[model samples]
Target: MRADAKKNREQVLAAAGIAISEQGVDVSLRDVSRRAGVGLATLLRHYPTREALLEALLHTSFAELTAKAGELETSSSPEEALVSWLRDCTAWTTQYQGVTELMAAAIEDVESALHASCVALRAAGARLLTRAQAAGAARADIDGTDLFALVAALAWVGDQPSLESRADHLFDVVVSAILTCAPVLGDRRPTEEVSS
Candidate 1:
């Protein structure tokens, strides 16, 4: 690709990301082109359709997430690693909207790059979950597929700003239930009264 063409392509991807994050995946290619300050022909040259743009965005996001996961190397116990992963996942989920919708759409009867990325993400997440379980932190009964579903559902539920408090509550509840340790009963604080 020529220098100008490469710049145009980058602009289109950036515009598409913002459009999808703000408007939705259904945003028109013309709007994306305008957002990129490029002609519609140029936008189409890089991404043939809305699905293609969405695929590009999803691919980038998933790749970043997988890379982050791969870099997670805490010397803490399995529970700590699991908690760190969960916190990272939650923060990403809270920041990105419509990600699950795009992912679900990608898994349809369409052949696209997004499918491959999703598969990779699932495999990576499963590997992490397995390690965590082997170290005796997360519940043995839960698998990666379950973790994926839980994260997706939790993201949707916690997307709202007001729901943050509820999200934290839900997180604690789920974490307590999924951990192999003794249940944490409410908030444990040292008693101030001296029995002696």
Candidate 2:
């Protein structure tokens, strides 16, 4: 890309990030263009649609979460890794207002621009889940897709004003239910049978 074009893209993304964070995912693209000091044509040329713009804004975060899953797989016990990463996913989804809903929709819509990123993010969680199950820490009946859904659900709940404080308790309860052998309370390590 030409220097000027790249600059325009960056500006649009930056302005969109602020607008979306402050206003919402539904913030006007025209406003984004105005904030970025770019024309509507240029904004459309770069992002094409609101979903495309959101995808661009969230791509880096999704990629980082995916990479973090890989790192956690090696650094923490399987159960610990899964639990830690789920918390991270929740935080990521709730970064801005209404993002959890957008993510839930995007993950199911193959046609959406954000779908690929959502898929990659879910795949990462699935990898950790697979490892946890294989190690006999997680329930064998559940799959990566199931884990992804649970994460999304928790994020959705977290987004609710009345449920925000209960999110951690809900996470713990759900995660415990998903485990084959319940983890010791407050302990992140896998059980002796699984670890050995």
Candidate 3:
């Protein structure tokens, strides 16, 4: 792609993210073009259809998330990395409820960009879960599929308008449940435990 075209595409995706968050996935292309400060024709040139635009947005978000997880692999502790990644994941999901809906649509259709993201997310989650388990700080029985489902459910919970105030606490509970051998209640860190 030309440099200008790539920049325009990036702008459109960024604008679409905000528009979708503020309005919804059903937000019109004209609105997205306005938000992007681009002509509708240019926006259409980048993403010919609403589904195409949505798929690009989802793909971008998922790629960023996967990259973050990969970078976190070098963290001092797998447990901390996992918790941090989960928090990031929650924020990403909550930030774009439209993406969640798009994903669901793709799953039902089974031939959308969301389907590709599902595969990628599962692979990334498996890597994280495996690392956490290897560190002896996460449940071995919990598979990537289970974690994916959990994240999806958490995203839905986070999307609730009424639950907005309690989102952090809700996510904390999830983290607590997933963290094995974590200092519980009033217990102090084990004397020989490696610090995170």
Per-candidate TM equals 0.80, 0.84, 0.79
Tens-place lDDT per residue, model 1, 74-141, is 45456665666665676666555677666655555358557788777766667777887887866789
Clashing pairs in 2: none
lDDT, candidate 3, 79-122, per-residue tens: 87777777787678777765665665565566675677767766
lDDT of 3: 0.78
How many residue pairs clash per model?
A: 0, 0, 0
Cα displacement (Å) at residue 27, model 2: 1.6
For model 2, residues 5-122, the per-residue Cα lDDT tens digits are: 9999999999998898778799999999999999999999999989889999999999999999999999999998998898899877766777877877888899988899889998
Q: Distance (Å) between predicted and true CA of 9, model 2?
A: 1.7
By TM-score, the candidates rank as 2, 1, 3
User: Which of the numbered candidates is closest to the native, going by highest lDDT?
Assistant: 2
lDDT of 1: 0.71
Worst 10-residue stretch by lDDT in candidate 3?
183-192
